[model samples]
Target: MKVGILDSTLREGEQTPGVVFTMEQRVEIAKALSDLGVSMIEAGHPAVSPDIYEGIKRIVKLKREGEITSEILGHSRAVKRDVEIASELEVDRIAIFYGVSDIHLKAKTKTTREEALNVIADVVGYAKAHGVKVRFTAEDATRTDLNYLVRVAKTARDAGADRISIADTVGILYPTKTRELFSYLVREIPGVEFDIHAHNDLGMAVANALAAVEGGATIIHATVNGLGERVGIVALQSVAAALKYHFNVEVVRLDKLVSVSSLVEKYSGIPTPPNFPITGDYAFVHKAGVHVAGILSDPRTYEFMPPETFGRSRDYVIDKYTGKHALKDRFERLGVKLDDREMEQVLAKIKSSQGTRYFRDVDLLEIAEEVTGKVLKPRPPERIEAVVSVKCGSNVYTTSVTRRLSVIPGVKEVMEISGDYDIVVRVEARDSTELNNVIESIRSVKGVESTLTSLVLKKM
Candidate 1:
């Protein structure tokens, strides 16, 4: 299973509206993705200009801290100046591109088929002269004439281009078309690796990339949040996840998927779509009753993949839709059992309440104690005596409650804080310090959301 992941977010992702990354932002994202273990990172296209040139160098300098799976590379047109910048950066590879489509040739390059091949041969040779690997991409190959595509690709091969990328630019190629195009590249373009870079207008970028891979394309290009020009590029998270889960090929580490996506989203000012595959906030969030039920029963039953694999958790969202069994299971784990009817009542009470991180098993027990005065403890303390208060949610209606106390050393007397106590407590402790500990412990209790602790002003 040959696998490689190329992060194009810096080059393509920065093209999104309101998206800009400072040199520091690009360096940090590069280090983080390098730590994520991608085999290749497209640092940026140096042909963009000198400022972009310096940013790529910054990332290249940061790579010396330690070796990671990702090696930084730059994108460029098939030209001498672009290849020279890559040489200056000391990058690992250069994606020297040519707009192969007749449309682009007539409008942009204004060159004949023979002339285009010369440019491909000249620039790739220039890059090879500087000891840089070169990848030749037939820009808009999906729309280019097959004969010219073959001719230009052969030119790149003769010039020592290491890989050929068949770009499905504009997301125009569906699976069948993409697979056919890649199949042709594999058969016709001899002695070079082929890659597929797809866009997402029709939302088949990942499928197309995979189809190309199965058709003998070795590398898949992606961006963290699918951030790129227009409809965005193939998502790094989706393609990496698909390869791991579907093909049983382990290439990229899923754990850093969220971190990389998050940093790019932050720096690029593009919040990950809530429903984006894997990294979205709602990717593993469960709210529906059956979905939560299925998750609680067997997470794998309802989930396509485990959330924790991507540095996320399978979260059972609490809501009006949250089931009683979920809450009952929450209590049963704490050695407390409630009848279905009792849990029904408890769930109702919680549904009626708001603004909390869901109750823990212990909280359910406390609720049970408050409502029915049922002590859920399996072993009630012998000589057990403690103050009990009545609370409806948070409002304690009475000023006092009865308390019974006993001591292990068998103290003959119980002390009570009289009427002034707001609510009285009669308890036993080993000594004065122990007594203070008991008082402080209860003071920290939650239903008593606030506390005012004071030692007796003067001993009786």
Candidate 2:
């Protein structure tokens, strides 16, 4: 059976503490997910507020208008009112969940097992009667008694629920236990589609989800950037890449994964960790000498999934661990070729530069010029200076432009001066060609309107 994804970034992910999405952000995220070809987008829990209800309705409208191909689903509790809120939106599917484990039933819901079963059946039946698809989730299912869980699943199915979801609410399941649970349910339940909603409390969400898929789960619940209540749920980027690269299961459009993830990261206010899998800042960056050398020769040597598969590019960090091969490759990419002697000098200078964290393309170029006693281009000048003036739209733009300009290789200083120009920039270059290139780059900045440059004939 083909595995499907139900992205719950809007529903569960928003439950992350201090995380809230505007209605516009919710619709944008839903559209991004649909564009990425997700099987379903759990828009949000409409019972939370009227604004959220309207947002879900808008997503449904988008789907009906053929703007988004994926199905729109809404979250609900195993209560008549919650299901009613979801049904009013006319969503494609309604995901209704109830606490099933002994602890949850005793303390959380304060209801008996039989009463919980009735609630599930009533809500599932009500949602089904409305002709919208129903997915009945057993919250804390992994922690529940197996026989009782089976009975609950049967109750929902007999009442006409379309699917069953087993939630590892506390993220306690490892791969082995996850496999056993799904295997037993698939064998006993017979013909009912099982979905896995694994959390990351113990940091095993992705692993357990995959194990569930192995044991016959047809759908997996995920959130972009892994945003959720506590430690969050399975990350969509991690699971999608793992499924395709490891199990050869093609679920969503891998190319759009990064873009979708970035959009979520931007709106959710949750920064994707540098070390996060697949779409993180440093996920595809190589640093060590050996690894960089291997990557330079063949990326497959150190990288299992190519960055391009997820619309990301691979980069090598130039630091103390950098190898000559990596340095040479970087130089070649910048269109600067260094001879063997010049390469050594530059390498030695890089190694000797105390407390240097890393080098950018411009940094390397400056180093090469310093080592060779010549500029990159022929006919080097003794010294070149230029004064640049910038007109910015706002204080934010002026501040941002000044910060970016101060980091360029040849820039001496940048000041936010008031007059006709919002900022004045001073740059020193080894040659006229380098001066022109730097000035053009400064003019190309997003906020810069125009610039006037004057050469320094002599510095007293």
Candidate 3:
């Protein structure tokens, strides 16, 4: 399956209060993320700091040194300096963001629509001339007049935007509306690639992402753990999962998802809640007795997928909702079964009885035997590990998981995986003593935070 993941943690993730990454930290995170298998990395906005130039430079160096196959990109405004800085850094791609909606054009840029179009022509053309692949972002494009959005995107394409991103900057679009708008843009415009950058203000980021894709969007802009301005942008985990699990698209390495999210969390200091999609701690965990039972019998029964498909493991959370049917169902494959009458009897007992029922396979059989004349024989389950692949254009991802992973540096790589936690990495530390130096250096990457490193048996 193929889906691209953009790390805005440096740009947007840093926007979270009290979140700051030294140049070293930024480099560390970026390197780790590159190893994690995201197709693209939005390194950061060079316009934000004097050190940004140095940061981008270091990122390019790290990517090259680590043999990272991912693309390195920089963000800019639709202006000369923004494009100039990215060109200076030699980044492969540059995204120039501007407000095209009438409201932003008037309030933020204070330029008329014609003036804005002129700016687009001038700046975007310049960036292309400088030999940088361009992606022009019409900020808040969803709210802009359709005709105007077309005008701006066409102008950018004419100026040589390899692609144009239609942004729902305020997260106000519904899935159907998003599909309608993007489909119109797709049918109306044929050559240039369409991209979507949706926000999560209304908790519809994933829904909108899928809608845009259906409308012919080939690229998606997302942040780790959905970190960004206001409610955040599309989440790397959510989009990756949708593309992989729901649409059978391939642009991500599902096995590396957790490893990627953890790094973002540590660097950005914005934790993905337990329930966040895909990478969230509870995303694949079964807590209810019924769910747990289903998983125990056949993971696909309740999960439709195994956690390992996404670099995660399944977990069973004990709670007050346990039921004997659930208990029996879970261990049924282990030659455990309860007759229908016994099943109803157990339910009645539990409904009236107090205390928690912690069921194990043995306990289930014992209960079954007490009610039945014969003892049930134990049998090994007929377990199978199978994969179903689909062909979509040039990508193939299972429609079940958003697998993700990472390379390592203690304290840095572990934190930026986004959405949730997963430990998967191989760090290159020269020695135990220099691990601190490794830590400091690793922290410079964009999404790195914690390391999953152990002391070496012997330093080479």
Best model number under TM-score: 2
Worst 10 residues of 3 by lDDT: 385-394
lDDT of 3 by residue, 36-116 (tens): 666678888887886767887888877777666678889999879888888888888999989999899888999999999
Clashing pairs in 1: none
TM-score of 3: 0.72
Tens-digit lDDT string for candidate 2 (263-304)? 776566566667889887788999998999998889999999
Candidate 1, residue 391: the lDDT equals 24
* Better model by TM-score: candidate 1 vs candidate 3: 1
Candidate 1 RMSD computed on C-alpha atoms after optimal superposition onto the true structure:
14.7
Per-model TM-score, in order, reads 0.74, 0.82, 0.72
Candidate rank order under lDDT: 2, 1, 3
The residue-by-residue lDDT of candidate 1 on 306-373, one tens digit each, is 88888898776555667865665556656677777777777777777777655544456667776666
Q: Which stretches of candidate 3 lie over 4 Å from their true place?
A: 1-3, 325-460
Q: Per-residue error at 261 for model 1, in Å?
A: 1.9
| RMSD after CA superposition, every candidate | 14.7, 6.7, 12.2
